[model samples]
Each structure stands twice: as structure tokens, then as C-alpha cells.
Target chain A: MHPLVLQYDGDSEEKISKIMTEEIIIAGFGGQGVLSMGKILAYSAIMQDQEVSWMPSYGPEMRGGTANVTVILSSERISSPIINTFDTAIILNQQSLDKFENSVKPGGVLIYDGNGISRHPERRDINIYRIDAASEAAKLGSAKAVNMIVLGGYLKVKPLVELQNVVKGLAESLPQRHHSLIPMNEKAIKRGMEIVNTVHEVG
Target chain B: MKELKLMKGNEAIAEAAIRAGADAYFGYPITPQSEVLEYLMAERPHERTGMIVLQAESEIAAINMVYGGAACGRKVMTSSSSPGISLKQEGLSYIAGSELPCLVVNVVRGGPGLGTIQPAQSDYFQAVKGGGHGDYRLIVLAPASVQEMADFVDLGFELAFRYRNPAMILTDGALGQMMEKVWLKEPKPRMTEYPEWATTGKTPDRERNIITSLELDSGRQEKFNLKLQAKYREMEEKEVRYETIECEDAEYLLVAYGTSARICQKSVQVARENGIKVGLLRPMTLFPFPKKILREMAPKLKGILSVEMSTGQMVEDVMLAVNGLVEVEHYGRMGGIIPAPDEIVSVLEEKFIKQNYYG
Candidate 1:
């Protein structure tokens, strides 16, 4: 059996079983790779032989507009892909932060990139973390790795999936021609992991 | 051999069609379903399996192309969303009337008109009751997951050719857009020879096959209609496919199909956790309706809730199937809104458990 599958066994640690099911919403502007973040995370879960679903807003809503995707990863079968609330919300911009902050479940995690947010997350019941993913990607000389950076921050907090699986997922999600950029993406993820700060939390 | 891959439902359908030895795919681009065409184009099935993929000028042209190809005994299909499907209704009716074997996929979006580009099962009545004009029915298969979306392509074609009729895959935007792991079937080689009934250039020793829906003689047309009815009856008898979970000792039953069925499954889990005896009945083939199962289970259930994305389409079918043996209620969210599992659980409790248990 896959190591990840064994992690969900009944005798596994309580923390592993408690977070076995992760419902996430990633939202941002069209070009910010919000949907791609969700796609990569979903792919990583699939690599671990986990049940996963990724649903993105398509068509006009994705053309120069706010785009979002819902991703669910579970040890068991996922019943529905479309969900109203999320266990985690990865908001990349001010609009996304405003739109999705309230949808995060109480005690859930909300990770946001500080680049586009003017108003901070106000939710008291949820854990909020901020990472400057855009600046990190810019520093790495690849502005497109913003999503990867955000994903790295999410993993650091949640630790639901392993980083090696995420690298494999990145190769699967991107075309072969762009594979050289994987190293840059990996750098961005590590930068995100190092830079994320917890802004708010509940006792 | 089982090869597992993560794929969107739309992409899975396209790959499965090619693997199923589909001869041609004719479709216009439409949201939540464009991946079906996009994947076919990207994969270049023509080069791989010699399957032809064409982007027609419109959905009307696409359905007509499917009709033309199917008449030649080629495994052909077309896919579209709700509004685009409306455009193909005329061609669909002609395909059914002429008794052509083909696949028509509708990745349904919300609708009465050009509704939201989100998932909705409002097309349930249109698909199962024959949306096009005439006394005709297309064998309808409802796929809830990406795996089913892939598997049903071959199943739909098999049933279609078995009865010499068109088969429709009725799915919603959520199922079409969502990504999941799918175990792809082994690729079947494309058919090189045409069947005897096909309009493949008639041989000198055989009578030429004429493909047309128009029967000049009214009496002959009436007889043809009766033959079609008999075929539908056969399908109803033999093709009713469904799955039941925890129905053996359940006080509450939920009837749902496609994406709604997935949500209802979650509701079943939640209700069970709360000590409510809730079961889920998923209709795999919507046209056959799984009436027999419902009729049998209705007597043992305290109440049935028809959960759907539409206001109340399949509920009517449930009521008809139950025949007033139990109280049937519908809880739905229209205009592309999906009801959450918690919402479904609350509604189920209010409608059945609370009223009966606390009253």
C-alpha cells in the first residue's frame, strides 16, 4: 500500500485521521494561478492514491474576472465537488479575501497572499495566515510561481500532503516543454514556507 | 489492465469515446463541456485510432453530422451544454425517428433559457421524457463521477446499438468540470466493416438501406411508432440501472441522480451520524427511472425526499413511481445553485424526522 494510504489507517495518529479530509477553496484574479494552485494540490493527492475532486469556475467568470476553484482531498470517497463552505481558503487578492473570508469554516485555516489585500481578514473563529507570495515569486525571478508559493505556505500549515508528491504533481500539471521551471517553482514553495506568518488565531 | 489517471469528467469522456472505438465526434464548443472537444483535438484521436473529430459551425450542424455518421453504422457522438443542446433537439428527434445509433451528451447547466453556466439537473424531464418533438425516447444515462463519465460512453453506445436508437448521457456542469481519478478501459480497435443494416454503399447482392424518418404512408408510420414504443418497453424492462446504500433498514429515503446523487450520499452519511436512518437511491439510468426499486422501497420507507438541482423535475417521477405509498417531498436549488449536504440533512430532518419523530 502507498505510504499516504497507510497514514489514514485506523491505528494512525489522531492528527492524521482528523485532517484526512480537506476541503479547500483557492480564489484570486484570473491570471494569478488560483485555479492552478487547486489543480496542483488535487493532482498531488491523486498521486498518493487519495480520493480528490477539483472544480473551477469556468467561462466568462474566468476571463479578466475573479476565478476560484474548490478542491477536496479525502482518504474515503468524496461525495460532492461543489461546496458552499471550505475547511481552508487560500485568498490571493483583496477581492478574493473579501469574497471568501466568511465562507471559511470556524476553526478552519485561511491563508492569503498579502500583495493585493488592503483590508485584512476579520474572522475571529478561523486561523488566518499571510504570505507575500507575489513578492516571493518576483524575488525568485519568476512571477508566475505565485501559486506555488501559496501552496507551499498551505502545506506548511496543514502538512496534509508531502512536498515530494507536490513536485511530482507539478510535473503532471504542466506541459513537458515548461518542465525546466519546476526548480524555480520549488524555490518559490520553499520561500513561501519560510515567510508565512500567522496573523490571527482562535484559542 | 487498469490504468489510473486523474482527469476531468469532460476529458475522461473524450478519452473513453476514443478507447470505445468511436468513429467520429462532431461538436461545437460550449462551456463546462468544451473540454470534450478540446481534449479530442489535443489528443488528435484521428492520428491515434483513426477517429475523426470535427468542430461543427453550430450544435445543429454537429447533431446532424452525428446523425449522418451514425446512419453509416459508425460509432459517432456529439456533446453540448443546456442551451446548445436545445439547438440540437430538432436533429435529436430526427435521429431517434430514423432509429440511428449514436451518442448525445449534455453537460447540463442551469436553464429555462440561457441560464447560468453552473451545474443543474433541470434537463432531467427534457432528457428522460424526450425533449424533441415526436413520440421518441433516447436511452438516458446519468453519470455522477468522472469515472462514470468515462465508463458510460461505451455503455451508452452498447445500449444505443442494441436497440438501434440514440443514447444520451445526462450529466451536469459540476460532473463535467470536476477532476477525479479514473481507471481507463482497454482501447478497442475501430470498426472496419459496416453492419448489414448500415447505409454503407449497398452491395449488389443486398437491398440498399434507405435512412429516413419520413414514412409517406400514415399506417406504416403508426406501425413504426408502435415498434418504437415496444423498444422503449424493452429498455424499461432490461435497462433500469441503479445503486442503493443502506436501504435495507432505512426510515428515510432520498432519490437523486447525477451530481445531486453525490451530495445526497454525503447527506446519508451525516444523517446516519446523527442517528437518522437515511438511505440514498441513485438512479444510474434515468430513462429507465428505476421505478421498480422505488415501488418496492416506498412501502418500507417513512418518507422519500427527491433531492435535485432543479426546482422539482425528478420528484414527479418519484411520486409516480411510489404511487402515493409514502409521503414524497422535493428540496432543490435552481439557477445553477448546488445544495450543500448540511442543507439537505436539515431539510430531510424538517420534512420527515422532525415532523414525525417530534410531532
Candidate 2:
């Protein structure tokens, strides 16, 4: 039996392949915890026995400039840690929105915070969602929870990883001294999942 | 016990070195590869396996440190980026010339002279054909993933000792910085029994052991050179390693190594999805160059494309191997810019399926 057809009911050959391989790009400012989110996501995939690769943007731009990371979670061996397009792009800032809005493959998902985004995503071929994570973080009195909120918004839409695995990933990646903050981060994720607003849906 | 962990490439290599029972590591920190020294320092291999990890003042100093450790037949290694690698060339030549075993890792960045701190395979030529001035070759292993980054440290050390020559893991910034899951092998205790040629001091029961690359007599130097050539030939005959994907029915083949090879794997899948029969040939051992396999696969291939992160370095070797049995071309993106997978298929289609049709 073909691996791609594990859930097959004698249907289409291209059935559900996009779900098998999730090529995600998370981009924002240097201190946005963007790389950490990618790491946690990669670790979560590892706990599920999925092959994962995380490549970060560590050029001159990452020196207090824009930061980005490409995270791939796949059932098969992933090729090319570097890529031009993405299956999902979690954009945080205005610059990232402008750069990667059009990079989402047709019928893909785009999740971004509405904080710095002045000109919103203008693509109609992909599904776009808005999360006011900055405001939500301010409400929680923890500005550092912005990334988790946005990551939560991403999970509500895709749910590619189990919630328990994500929590375990959060605990595993965090230092023992910082493990007490996990509950707050989990709460921020729940708030994000609740507040994610749909903007444009392709289908 | 098999330990699995999600680790960056640099960290994996550092952890693997200690587990491989390496005696010492001397290195200077450079971007895209700084994590290696950092991880080593944090892990404190001196505590784990009693291995010595030192941060040398410069790349030159570090490679010489490796040379010193290797002279005593210790499993020693050093790592650096491009400009730092250029600084260690003289030391590399000396190590190769003296027939000492050592591992040198060049986590390559863009270069001519300090080009960029981004990933690139421009060092392919420098790595395969001796960068330092001499008639010698370093056993070069190009690792494509974080797993290979960890796995190659042991393989690199094994090969270096097998031939009594310097071995290098020629990876790029992308592989150095990326994070992936790797299953680490169980630890091996450090070697207490050194090789016979080691400078372990003269004793009443044995003759004095000397290690040097200098031979003042021209005739003796030529003989040494011939001996080195024979060693390299043996390596060529026995040590060529590569990986093939989707080639059973492939009409076109993409030859690449390291990060470029990873990208070409995706190109093979994309081309196949488009009803095109494409395959990927990834050379794991870049020094031995995988010439024998290419020669055998070339006759059946309608067209061959050499994809690299640099501009046409490895293509020369591919063209030489194929000997024009099939049409060959080169595609690349320079200055730390990685080529895309889908675009590689487009180049294959344009180059082979478009106008020129020769086999």
C-alpha cells in the first residue's frame, strides 16, 4: 500500500499530501521569540515521531533586525532545509507580511498579528486569518506571550500537533528554572485560539 | 543506548565527537559555526569523556594544535568557516604531508575573501583539490543533514586514521545552523593505545619515532609524493560514497552534494510528480568524487545536470567523469543564495527537454 494512501478510500492520488508535509515559516523581529516558536514546533513534531527540520535566518538581518525561521514537519524525510515558498507563513510584523504574503502556496493558510500590519494581506488565493496577539498579550500583562498567542492561533486552524505534545514540547525546551511559566504560556495559546478572526478563505 | 535528540548541526557534531571518543578539539569561533565550540564548552567533554576542548586564539593556531595532538596519534579535530579555513590551509598541507591523522571541518560560508556569513558550497573546489600548496588530498565528506553532521564526525575520524591523512567534513552554514533529530551512537572510550608511528617518545626497547613533512633530499621527497599518490589512489578505489534517489527509471540525473544535494532530492520528487523521470545523485564523499558510479550511470542517462550552491565547480568533475557520454550542464545560485527545488526541474526541462537532445 502506498504511504500517502493510508487514509485512502480508493480516491484521488493527490489526496491529503499537503497535510503530510507542513512547511512553515515563522518571521518577525529579533526578540519576537520567533526562533523559539519554531524550535518548540519542531520538538513537538519529534515527540510525534515525525521527521522535522528547523533552519533559521542568521544573516546580518538577525542582528537586532528582522528574524525568521523555516520549520518543516513531515511524515517522510524532508529535503532542502531552504525553500522559496511555504505551506504556511506565520507573519508577525509589517515587513514580514509584505515579504511573505504572496509566498503562500495557492489554497494555503496565512496567520499574522494585526499589530504592525498596516497594509493587510491582499491575496485571495490563500486563506488569511488575523490575530490581535499584541493586544491580547498586553491584556495578559505579559508582553513576551505574543508569539505563543500567535502560535495558538495557528493551532486552532491546523491542529497538526496534539495539544498535549505541544505542552510537553514547551516543557522540554524550557529550562528547569523557567518551567513555572509554562501555564501562563498555555493560557496565552488558549486565548489566541479563541480570538483568531477569519479574513479570507479560499474555499 | 541510542539517544535521540533535536539538536542544531553544530551541537550534534560536538556531542558526536565526545561520544566517538575523540581525544581533543581545538577551534576558533566563527559565525554559522560558533555553536560548535559553544556546545562543546557547555557540555564540557573534559567532564563527560575527559576530552579536551580548547578555544584557540586563531584558526591557524587551532589547526596547529590539532597537528600537535595528531602527531601523538590522538583523535583530534578543528573547525572554522571560510576565511578561517583559508588561514588553516598551510597547517592542513603540513598535516597531510606528515601523514598524520586529524579531522578538519569547514562549515562553509560564501567566500572569495569574507564574502558573506551565509551558507554556500563555494569551497567545493578548495576542499576536493588541495587548497594549500602541495600534491595532496584531504578525505572530504559532505554531510547533507544534521544527522550526517553528527554521524560524519566518527566516519571522518575513522577515515583519517585509516589512511594516516587529514579528513574534512565539508558542510555549509545551512547545515551548520539547522536543527534536526539525530540518533547518537553509544560512547566509545578514548584510545590509550596509540599508533606505531606516533611520537610517544623513544624507549630502550624501540627505535625513536619522528613525525615531520620535511625531506631535504629531492629524491626522497619524490618517493614520499609517490607514496602519498598511492594512498589517495587506494582511497579512490575503495572510499567513494554516494546516495541515489528515484533513479531506476530516471532519464535525467541531478548531481549534487551537501546542501545542494538535499535541494535536488526535492527536485527529483517534483519532476516525478510532473510526469518527468528525474533522479538525484548525492556524493557523500566529495574527495573520491564518486567517479566510478557516474561513469556507469552516465551511459544510460539522456542528460545530466550538476546543481551546486556555487557557479560550476563540481560540474567539471561530472563532465570529466561522464566523458561526454551524455549532455551535461551546470545550474547554481551564488553568494549564499540557495537554489530552489521546483526551479531545478525547470532548468532540467529547459536544458534537456527543450532544444538539445543528445545522448
After superposing candidate 1 on the true structure, give the runs of residues whose Cα lies further than 4 Å from its correct spot. A1-19, A201-203, B356-359
DockQ of predictions, in order shown: 0.33, 0.40
**Cα-based lDDT at residue A135, candidate 2:** 90
Q: By DockQ thresholds, what CAPRI class is model 1?
A: acceptable
Specify the highest-DockQ model's number.
Answer: 2
Across B231-320, the per-residue lDDT of candidate 1 in tens digits comes to 999999988888887676889999898999889888887887799988888888999788998998888899999999988999999999
- Per-structure clash totals for the candidates: 0, 0
Worst 10 residues of 1 chain B by lDDT: B350-359
Off by over 4 Å in 2: A1-19, B356-359
Clash list (residue pairs), candidate 1:
none
DockQ measured for candidate 2: 0.40
Q: What is the lDDT of residue B176 in candidate 2?
A: 94
Error of 1 at A46 (Å): 1.2
Steric clash pairs (candidate 2): none
